[model samples]
Every structure is written in structure tokens, then in C-alpha cells.
Target: MMQLDDETLNAYLDGELDPVVRADVEAALARDAEARARLEALRRVSLLGRTAVDELSRLSVDESLQERVWPLPKPEPDCPAARTGRAMTILSGALVLLLGMGLGAWLFPSSPRLAGEAAAVATAWPRQAAWFHHLAAERRTHARPLVLDVEGSEPARLQVELNRTLQQRVVVPDLSDLGLRPLGARLLVEQARPLAQIFYQDAGGNLVSLLVALDSGPDTRPRFERVDDGPATAQWRRANTRYVLVGEPERVRLQDLVPVVAERTTR
Candidate 1:
């Protein structure tokens, strides 16, 4: 019989080995006190990780708790799973927004809270609503899309319902290779003008809203500001369109995605 090396034993513990190897390791563990202790330790770590994750999931409900970390509607207090999920939402979200702009959220003492809060509240809204408003306003004013299709495209106008309008907005990366999909085209408008917004989502359920506004550019670039104590936001202007992305206070993923939004708007 082959001696069970520590390396092979560890691989077996982590479930990285083949079934026969795992069986061998298990058999050895059953016979050896030392191996049994080592296996127990690994099991303990795995259990600890799962427990920590579960605990965090329980604490982050949208209810009016001591610190309502989340801005969305609250789940019933009786629903443990929803509570767990929402808590994870807030925890993960906080990690993202907080970490994303550490200097901005933590370092900036003046308006960090407001900037973060506003963006977070608006993050869930659909990009299509932003786009449709632009198109709809144009129809109402000049009666067309680009002053050509008077009466506006009824087919296109039918989109952007209140529910759709209320969907979460997000800033996404251009990961076309991963089979990621854009939210497609949606009309956007600000101040009664036409615009377009593209959206995308990732495996983690984070949504991004991107709009190509036809509205006049703000005289200045979008700045980081807090809104009602939610997430810190990065709002800026690229020539004509406005860029606003909001999320939890600390997120490396969102930070990495910001530049892609800028490039998309510019292009």
C-alpha cells in the first residue's frame, strides 16, 4: 500500500482528488488519530466559513432597524431566508460601495454620505426609463425621434412602464467574451429631451444603467456626492450625456467597471 502523504491527504480533504484517492484518504483518516484530527480541522474551517456567511445574511434587512443598511423594501421579519439574503445584499453592497471609494466615502467627511445614498437609491431603476423619457419628451415637444418620426414610434413608446422605470440601475463592464448581455436599447430623457441608455447584468445580480443623453451637458463634470446616507456616487458629464453609478461603499468590481462606462458613453 502507498503511504498517505500529507499533500495527498490535504488534496483529499479539499475534495480535489479522484474518488478512489478520496476513499483511500478517508480510510486512512478512519485508522489514524492524527489524520482524523487534521480532517476535523479542515471541516471546522469550512463550517466556520459557512456560518459566518449565514450570520451576515441574517442581519441586513431593509426594515427600519437600528441601521437600515439597505434602501429597498423590507422582507417580512418572519422570513429567515429573505432576511439572510437581504443582509448579504447589504453586507456585500456595503463592501462594494465602501471599498470602491474608500477615499471618497471614508476620507471625505463632508458629502460622502449623501452622494452614496442618492446613487444607491437610484441604482435599481432601469436605464430604459432614462432613455424612454428622452424619446417621449421629444415626441411630446417636437413630435418625433430626432424630429423625423412625428407621433413618435408608438412601438418604442410602449416600453418603459412604471415597474420597468423602477428597476435597479447599475454600471457594468464590457465583458462581451463571458457571454454577458447588455440591457439593450432604451430611450432616455432629462428635462424633456431624448436620449438612450444601455444596461447589463452579471452573475451576481448587479445591474448597470448606461445612458447616452441628448440633453445639454451640465456646465461641469459629475462629482462624488452623498444622497440621503446611502451609497457614494460617481456622477460626471461626458460632453453632453451624464454618467451616474451608485452602489455599496466598497466594491472593487464596480470600481473596475467605471472606466468601461466612460468609454461606452464616449464611443
Candidate 2:
């Protein structure tokens, strides 16, 4: 029997394993509850890490601070080589500064402000949904196989399946007016709570996802936000359900559709 080590399980989750090895891991997972639990824990940790990185990348330094930290070179006569060199220098400096800030945050997480921010992020369902959306979008872009437990195009059927699996009412909002159609959905778990991500695509091939999860938090109206440099997201809680709509930032005006989805789901 193959040992289901962390590295092997991580590789399986990332779709980096060969068919034979993946089969072996799956077999082990089927028989070993401990292995399955370990895999889920790893998945949660990976999701949280990606979310933190996405949040960190969105941090912006003040323009004055950036200028003071890496003062631009004095302008010289127009030359391709000079321009390229200057651009490279600025890019490299920016990357270094970003990396340094990330390191500082990781090392000194005990800062009151930083700790509070971290706690808020950990509890934010919208951000978690955005992170999952980013992963799915990335895989779709790269033509990788999406690991969906339930796959289909019918909204009603998908809704029924999701609700059954989650043991909770799930609303699959129709966006036909917006030229989007249902593709499928996948189930996810966060802190043992179930989540469903319903996939949709527009006529132009733009992908969107609506993530539904049971919310114990207070009911709130839809609020729009961008997930770092990734998708545009609109999140809201209605009664006991939380919904997050995520789509391509350039192609989707998530705020406009928030009302449409909210009304339909609420009804």
C-alpha cells in the first residue's frame, strides 16, 4: 500500500499526479478516514494561504512613499535601451518592496492592526468564495480539468443536486437576461460547512461563479468588491444563506447583477 503522505496528497489535490498514482491515492483515501481528514485540512490550509497572498498583493503603498523609496532616474535623451533599463529597474524595485512587505507581515503578525485584519479575512466568506473562483478561473484558462462532483448544464437539476448534497436549500439564480447560462457546479467544504459553486458562462465565453453557503451571520445587503487583482465579487446574506457572485473583473459589472440575483434567490 502506498503511504498517503502530505506531499502526495498535495500533488493529488493540485492535479499534479499521474493517473496511476492518483488512483492509488484515491483508493487509500476511500479506506482511510484519517487520510481523508488530512487531505481536507491541507485543502483548507492551501485556500487560506492563497487568500492571504491575494490580499497581500492588493496592498498599495502610498505614491509618495514609493517615489521616496525608489526615486526614478533623471530623464535622459530618448533611447530604447535606456527606457528598457529604467523600466526593468522600477519593476524589480517594486517586486522587492512587495516581497519585503509580505515577509514583514508574516514575521510580525502580532501587530494589533495586522492581527485584526487577519481575523477579519479568516471570517470573510466572500473572500473565500473569491479565492475559490480564482482557482477555478485559472484552471479553466489553462484548459485543465475541473474537479466537479456534479457536472451538468441544467440549472434546476443542478440546484436540486446541490441542495440534496448540502442538506440545505440552494437557489440557482437565472442570469439569462445577462446572456449567461449555467455550466455546472462543484461542492466545497469550509470548516466542515458545505459550499456550492455554480458555474456559468456568457456568450463571449466569460466565466462566472455563484457560491452558495449557509450563513449564520447577520443578514446583509449586497456589497461589491474586487478580489485583489482577480474577479469582481458581490456578496450578500439573505436569511440563512450567503451568496457570492464572482466574475471576470473586466467583463462583469457584478454590482448590476446583484439586485437581479438577490431578488430571484430571495423569491
Candidate 3:
């Protein structure tokens, strides 16, 4: 009898298995309660991911922020008036720049102030990781499901590829003991840094993600937080590398797994 592994069940659910194998799997599922449960778990996870993506798609951008990023164009006046307006605009912009520079210099005379601003931006990784976690879930539900850059079946290759891409040695911890199997991984660019996202799913079909990126900010221990009511995330920095673990709060207590993941990833 052919063993019903996750790969086989997943392929069967995806309609990717050959007819002969599909028939065999179906026949097995009829009598195998465990196999049936696994199949249902996969289906449930997929549905939840799609629902999350749909909710995200329906969200509206803040009107005030939208206007600031893309201001409406004013109606053009006569050529003479337009030229005059353009000159005035340039003159006003220069004045504002000068005034802003003067104020900044007065408020913060040291270069450390500028460095502090950059550090503030670096601290936004938690929110960024949460957003990308949703994005990955969305991609998974598409008709053509997202193809991982590195398949999870080969842990060695996944680690090698991620290390090479990130230019740093990193560990991909085995979460199977925690009932979460590695699904795959993808490389992403966030905040001008290379980010590696490793995807995982539990037996119940709950999705979990781990994101790794190079950090220039100070090191810190795991801090658990939620992002805009989406997923709960645990963020921490080890040395110069930042790690984020994202998952559905209702389904998983991401905080509990944070230290376990953190300890394993520390090399």
C-alpha cells in the first residue's frame, strides 16, 4: 500500500495527481480517517487564506494619505499666468527648503539625529513582515498557486539558497515537532534589503510564516504584536539579522513559538 504523505495528499487535493494515483488515494481516504482528516485540514487552510486575501482586497486606502502621495493637478491658466505661477512655485519651494533646513539644524545639530531617523524606519520591519505574510497567503490561493523559490522537501537546499541570497548564515528550524511542516520558501525585497520567507502549515491547516532579513538596528528579544487586526507577529533581532514569525492569532499562539524559533535560528 502506498503511504499517504503530505505531498501526496496535497497533490490529490490540488488535482495534480495522476488519475491512477488519484483513484488510489480516494480509495484509501474512504477507509483511512487520518487521511481524510489531513485532506480536510489542507482544504480548510486554503479557504482561510483566500478569505483573508479577499478581506484585504476590500480595504480602502486613507483618503488623506492618498492625497498627500498623489495630489490633484490644478487646471492650467493662460500661458503668461502659468509661467508666473511656475516661477512662484519654484520660489516658494526654495524658501520652504531653506526654512526646513534651518529648523532641522536648530532642533538637531548632531549627525546622530539623522541616524535616529533611519533607525526609526528600520523598526518598521514588524509591520512590513505582517503585510508580506498576508501577500504570501493571497498568492497561495490564486489559480496558479505561488511556486516557492526553494521547495521545502529539501531543507539543505533551502538553507543554502537563502544564505547565499541574504549574504549571511541563517538556520531554518525544523517545526515538524511542533506539528508545523515546512511548505516552501520565497525570496523577497523589503526596505531595500533581501528578505527570506519560509512558509509552514500545521496539521489543522493553519498557516505560519517566518521572515528573515538583514538588520542594521540594535538587537532585541522577541516582541509579540498584531498588525492592523491581521496576524499576530513575533519580532526579534539576533546580532544583525531580524526575524519575524507571523500567523493567525486565533489558530496559533505565535508568542510561545518565538523563543523556540529564535534559539534554533541563532548560529
Best by lDDT: 3
RMSD of 2: 21.5
Per-residue lDDT for 49-148 in model 2, tens only? 9889866755555857855763433324337796688679757744664576675654443343342343332225556777677767877776655656
The CA lDDT of each predicted structure is: 0.47, 0.73, 0.75
- On lDDT, the stronger of 1 and 2 is 2
Best by TM-score: 3
Model 1 residue 13 CA deviation in Å: 44
Question: For model 3, how does the per-residue alpha-carbon lDDT over 1-267 read when each residue is reduced to its tens digit?
Answer: 778999999999889988899999998889899989989999999899989987786566685784476343322343778768867974784466458666564343223333222222222556667666776676655633545799899989999999997999989989888998998888877445798999998998777999998875567756566665677777778879889898987898775688689888874
For model 2, what is the error of residue 60's alpha carbon versus the real structure, in angstroms, after optimal superposition?
33
lDDT of 1 at 175: 50
In order of TM-score, best first, we have 3, 2, 1
Q: Candidate 1 lDDT (Cα, whole model)?
A: 0.47
What 10-residue stretch in candidate 3 is worst by lDDT?
114-123
Stretches off by above 4 angstroms in model 1 are 1-180, 218-222, 229-232, 247-253
Put down candidate 1 lDDT per residue, 175-232, tens digits, no spaces. 5553334444454343354544444444553444444443333333344443444333
User: Which residue window of length 10 is worst by lDDT in model 2?
Assistant: 114-123
> What would the TM-scores of all predictions be?
0.33, 0.53, 0.53
